[model samples]
Target: MEEIFDDPTNEHRKQELGGKDPSPPELLKKIEQLKVELVQKEEKLLEIDLLYEHVSRLTDKIRTAAESGRHNTLLLAKRTNELQKKIKDRTQKMMALTAELSMRQALAIKLQQEMRDKEHFLMVVSSRMDQGLPLPQETESEWLKILRNEKIRSEAAEARARHAAEEAAATAAGGVCSAAQRRPAVYIPDSDYSLPLPRPYGALAPFKPPEPSSHMRHYRKPIIKPTEI
Candidate 1:
């Protein structure tokens, strides 16, 4: 590098006397100039190192936040599935109720159809890609809201189904209609409930370190200065 920084053309027969050595004073002056340049280069390198360290810290924080959000989403997905299963169990019980044949033959056909539809809901609402992709907080919040609405709805639906089941039990026993006035509300599947998707296990993927850049090939961690000359 020092040779390259030297004069290119001959000013005082330097080209013809190329084999001759420089004077002692000239050599010292050249060494001083190189020292100055080295100091400037080192200062620039220091600035770059500080920048890389700052960038690395920020990147790590961002990834940690993303992982946390994804974990929360997985928990939400699990809770929602539990609620769905609860509702499905209640639906099955309601469908199994033995109503009076004369009054419920047509209703039996409808319940059977709904039961088949309920069978299709054995899975969950979350997509499997959640294994690799980070879930947004806003999306998690929306899911929470959906679950709250479903919770309220399931309570109402459960009450209706339980009442119907009791009525059928009474009819099976040949008991006269007890009045809370003899009609029981039927459970209808809510269209707002998303169709079931294949459920995926929520597990963190194994971490693989990123490849180092040309300048960073020597270091493994967040930062390490290059070897000095």
Candidate 2:
């Protein structure tokens, strides 16, 4: 059993091939080789430590960059939201202004039609009077209503002209007017239109009132004469 367990090559070499223990030179060579391997292991350990430190520095830089990115991202999101809110508000204001403009245009068209019809009616009445025909009775209520409408329109036009002039003066002076201006509201007799006045919107110019027609030149006097009597 001992023979089986023992190394066969070493003993057989000593007996048959006359092999001996390694020489001093061979032993020294092996020791030197082992020392070289030890130095290589030390250098490899030092390199690993340097690489570890470098990796730690890189990780720290990446972490700082990531934190800065997060802060910047939050700031950007907040600014973007504020800008969007402003845009939404402006959009709503623009839509409201557009609706107001359409309403004003419709009102103007209706007023123009009424003016044309009144002009035609006045022409007929004037012709009848010129021919010495029987005149219709003057309507006090109707005349009062017409005067009220004309006064309102005139006031509104004046207001708009003043506003434009003030704006222009303010511009030339590089400042704005702080004066609170009042707008004229249409007061229809027994109607619910008394508050919402027309704003000074349109070109940067004074509002010019329509020119008085020749037929309308003698209209107010006849109506007033009848009312006084």
Candidate 3:
């Protein structure tokens, strides 16, 4: 009994039993109660350990999720910066292209105007030449020489026709009608009239003189003078 009380493990039991040795039946029942209480205390300790493990796992998961969220946010910010830079570069390129296009368009318009001016100059030159007008500060070109020769030829032809007509009139007034004058007269054809000469794209027809009519022909009649006085 002294040994039992001296042990620290039985001290609380000794106090509860009033420092007396318990009867066999009471000891048995007390031993059974102590065993049940020990089991209950061990079960409570096991439940506390399980709850701590669950809380530790949840804390680790929350920490990992926070780190991942921060990393993703950084990545999104970096991508946004890169996209903004690319957009700025693309916008500058577009502006350059637009300026180049405008310059090209202006150049094209200027070229077109120059072409129109050249065409107008050519038209004026062609029209002047066709009208037989004199050129500015006339140089002695081949075309000019040809034109002068044609004018001279035309004047000569007109003078010859006038002379022939005068001669026929003088002959008729002197009262001489010839058999040649009585012949059938050929009339001038409409196609023989003078017209503006065409450019030298084709063969140029030679100038033709007008034909004399048979009515213009006259014979000299012999006059009988009085017997030699």
The number of the candidate with the highest lDDT is 2
Please give, for residues 1-229, the per-residue lDDT of candidate 1 as tens digits: 4565475763543425347788999999999999999999999999999999999999999999999999999999999999999999988877667444535888878899988865643222233244555455665788899999999999999998998998899899997657644232332334567544433333533344566669876766767679999
Q: Which numbered prediction scores highest in TM-score against the true structure?
A: 2
Write candidate 2's Cα lDDT for 1-229 as tens digits: 5664485764543435676899999999999999999999999999999999999999999999999999999999999999999999999999999999999999999999999998987887898889998555564567788999999999999999998998899989997667655434333234486545545444443545666888887666644444564
| Ranking of models by lDDT | 2, 3, 1
lDDT of 2 at 228: 60
| Tens-place lDDT digits, model 3, residues 1-229 | 6777778876464544357777999999999999999999999999999999999999999999999999999999999999999999999999999999999999999999999997986787788899998654433475688899999999999998986787799797894644343332333334556445443423444445559767766856589988986
Clash counts for the predictions, in order: 0, 0, 0
List the lowest-lDDT window of 10 residues for candidate 2. Answer: 182-191
Q: Tell me which of candidates 2 and 3 scores higher on lDDT.
A: 2
Candidate 2 backbone collisions, by pair: none
User: Residue pairs in steric clash, candidate 3?
Assistant: none
lDDT to native, each model: 0.75, 0.83, 0.80
